[model samples]
Target: MQSPAEDSTTHAPTRDCDVLVIGGGPAGSTASTFLARRGWRVAMLEKDAHPRFHIGESLLPMNLPILERMGALDKVAAIGVRKSGADFPADGGGYNVFRFERALDARCDHAFQVRRSDFDRVLFEHAAGEGVDARQQLRVVSVEPLACGGSLVSAIGPDGPCSWRARYVVDASGRDAFLGGKRRIKRRNTRHQSAALFSHFEGVERREGVDAGNVSIYRHAHGWIWMIPLPDGVTSVGAVCYPDYMKTRRGDSEGFLMRTLRTVPEVAQRMAAATRCADVHATGNYAYECTEMAGKGWVLVGDAYCFVDPMFSSGVFLGMHGAEQAAGMVDAALREPAREAALQQALRRHIDAGTDEFKWFIYRFTSPAMRHLFANPRNVLQVEDAVVAMLAGDVFDNPRVRRRLRVFRALYAVTSLAMLPRALRNGLRRRRQSRVDFSGETLQAEES
Candidate 1:
């Protein structure tokens, strides 16, 4: 059996495992758990302890099946607030509500929004229960690929520095992008430069009945905001805006967030009587993609590989889904070394497929034509169902869904043509806005 050296005074002994996974977020936990179930000796190093706070609290219908496969669906369901649909409210006083039940796929009609701390802990603990050598409070500092095959990973935990030798490595470090950063492959997405300021609140108003748990998206002059309802009556509220807007911030994060929140009448009205229940948080330059996703001894998954806008709450779903895909590829690579190239290609295809499916909508989220389409969704050509299916994260593995998406894209194109002037104007404005760099500036303005 592979084990660490016992002599603490000497150089730290190198341990061994079939695979070493970095980060314990959804991607790390999912991949490690699945690999362990496959009988691989896996060790997962997580920088944070379980039940820790995390930002992505929303889940898509597609995530449910993966949870079921991991045998954690019941636990997730118990902690999650049932989310049946989503609501998008435009500044013009019009709105559109898309229900999951209306999606092209009939099996996945509902999802949930839970406290990420609770959700992640459930998955992490499940990984441990499945016999993964899961270690918390351990941060992977460096990973070096061995010439003979595999990698040597160095980490610092509560105890001190430690090292491990593994046949393969999986980087699921979320935004940390440990391996990607080391390889200098993480590239900022120039097309979608954005930032977010958010927090949780109690007493946020909810719609009656089935729509109570529906996540609400509100568009304002600055950008868009999301208000997601959680099971304990605590709602997650956040705004995704241009980097310039975030760079104009002033005061504390909470005050700046509140000032910005008050600008959106729809969101403001809902939060009028709400009480802040958590510290406000801000994140800038929220979109990026790694140029290389996989190589000989390592692979990047989830936010470690790419992070798009969170408009559709695709973060958790994409992370977990990528994990699912990586798990299979890792298994294949272990069994057949010669198939590494094929496995890498498959992984890339899976990642690209999901990102490409959502990126168009994300990039055009602020455009007038896209807004019009969303505000007035129609069933013509089964486009609405297709859009709903996309929101449900059903873009992959369904030929029918892909065909419907093509129709929806065609319709969007026609709509853009009909409003060419406005579309052109919005497109130009977005291009200019995307060029803004908020990285080096300290925002001082009280409001945007």
Candidate 2:
């Protein structure tokens, strides 16, 4: 663990570490701990305090093996929050609830619904305690790749500020790459754009059976909502909206979130007499991509590389999976100079696969046809089970996911025509309304 003195040192450390990691989210936490366990001296800097609020409470069924490999399952299970599966509600007044039991991999029959604040803090604390030179509340103000053979990172924190020179720097900085600005690699995506507002409450209505312990998706006219059940009986509910729908809100974050909920009958009925957990939370312009996720001396993990719609619960899974793939390369890059070219290529391939996996569902998630299809399940007999598994987050390590995703890609390409055209039509109508002859409403007195 990093001591208080280390937190305040101003000058860069004369001694270098095997790896310097910025950001203490799950990806950073996992990478630092894993590398440390392999006998490498690892240093991690987190900009925020522990137990800080975060989203993405729903876990994919596949997250267990990674947690187990990190030897943190007991820690995770200690604060275990039960999440049986998902219930997808559609705009056409229909839905179907799917459980992990229906998955081809029955071993992954369940996942947890956690408060990200607690869940992330646990990983950070564990990594620190496990001998990674970890510092909480440490912000990386600057990152300078050494001219010769390392990188220097300057950071600010509660105690004061500090910096270090590291042979290899792992940019597990989530989406807010402290170094991203330096590289000018971050930019928003407009084609498949989105925004979101979320909050937690204790009394949100839940369904019976597996559905009660599951996350619910309620589709509305403008967008879709997610209801996630957490361990302490608090449910996290949020909605992701299209760019144009987001523009209508202006500054009415709370009112907009509440009103959108009412647009969905099932969600409105459920929240009829419910109360807010805290103030309504809002986030917008929620799409971005980084031109570079890795480099000769660093790798960006989790949201730092790219982010799309969060509908699929791929945020945490993809983030940590990227860290896992970066592990082998980081291990090699630490000692072997000749291995970097191969490592960078491997890193790019891995990032591409992760992004493709995530983009598959995100592109189709908001399509009316997708909403229709999920609301009413179908397909050839050959693809049903695999589709179910894919929906359940059983993509990794399963060759079946590729075959099923290919089929889904075809389904979306054709069915989306009917949906995208309607969405475009609605946007055009709204734009025309905004342009209506407002001059008539104004009195002629000013002209006179």
Candidate 3:
């Protein structure tokens, strides 16, 4: 038997399993681990091998409890830099740090930042430890749901073709959203959109002492930039630019990214001595959602269901948390087939509620009112604490948080009214920018 810390390359041409999870990222691994621990025969397929390069290295404070629950906290802590808060450039000056401890939930006071290659492998390996049949470098080609039950999945592994007959399917394929794209249920989010260019750098300046590990956010006229401190003195830096600005790129990805970084004085200053250690990567169609989260014998988790702007670093938390909830619902549905529809509905409602909470803020994040409020926060009726809680991904299960968020929204509306002229001007620019289309095909292909 292979150790959980070791990847298994054992193969089978045909196999039957209770659950087939697509993608070995956070969501798929988390779901497979939970189902396997519940005694279900589970098989997880990953398109790429572990320790692969990926973006989204920053973790939210709420992710800590989930990691502990999955028994991978220590493994992650060993490789990740302890991140206590996030900072964004202020309207008039330096930066404002929103420490996790300031959030309403005291338990979620810190998180970690690591290279996604290492972080994802820890979770995937943990799932394998929990009895999941985890295999990598297997690209799922098709999933055909049977009328009776389950699905017939076809994939190409490292050696040759393979197939599986699964009683249920979970598509946690991150941004690929395999089922969503194949089934034609995925739709671009028109209200909010962006394209991202990111790379890792060595020698980028970090904050001092306790704040050294904090993620710094800088807002520019075109969009925003993120400077995330990772271990080994490598920092993950990226710029999320609106399509209109992105369409203005005249040169190579690296040159364009460097130019964009230079536009933000705060980021340019910090990177004055930094050296790019990795090739630049870019992705377009930054926001999208599937029309349906679950249907019949299949369910979608993480970016497969929906993806918004990552301004708040909510992607991983949302994906992993949804997977945890999905495992329970799927387990119940397997035993009571008649309640499948009801269970799926409940799951959709729960996931949508959490996503929408972040969406409200995300859609308005780049506006004049939001910029001013975040720059000058207040605790009137504990609204600032509520915003802090939301930043920490504590939107679910906290009645006080939910109640205070409503107050914060009301305050935001008042602020928008006060800054109506600037709000109207920025909104027009955003709308125009959102209309530009950027396939990002060349950018992604060059990476290969």
Best by TM-score: 1
Query: Compared to the true structure, candidate 1 yields what TM-score?
Result: 0.93
Q: How many clashing pairs per prediction, in order?
A: 0, 2, 0
CA RMSD, predictions in order: 3.7, 4.6, 5.2
Decreasing TM-score order of the candidates: 1, 3, 2
Best by lDDT: 3
lDDT of 3 by residue, 199-223 (tens): 9999999999999999898886678
Error of 1 at 349 (Å): 1.1
* TM-score result, candidate 2: 0.89
Task: Decide which is better by lDDT, 1 or 3.
Answer: 3
For each candidate, the alpha-carbon lDDT, in order, equals 0.87, 0.75, 0.89
**Candidate 1's residue-wise lDDT over 1-448, tens digit each?**
3657642433766789999999998999999999999999999999998888889899999999999999999999999999998988744675677999999865689999999999999899999999999999999888977777798888887788888889999999999999889999999999999889898999999988999999888875568889999977899999888866665665578876787788777678889899998888888889999999999978999999999998998999999999989999999999998999899998899789878889989988877878888888889878899899999999888888889888888988888789889867765765454433234443344433
Instruction: Return the TM-score for each candidate structure.
Output: 0.93, 0.89, 0.92
TM-score quality measure for candidate 3: 0.92
User: Which pairs of residues clash in candidate 2, taking residues 3 or more apart in a chain or in different chains?
Assistant: 174-304, 175-303
Off by over 4 Å in 3: 1-12, 425-448
* Candidate 1 local Cα displacement, residue 416, angstroms: 1.5
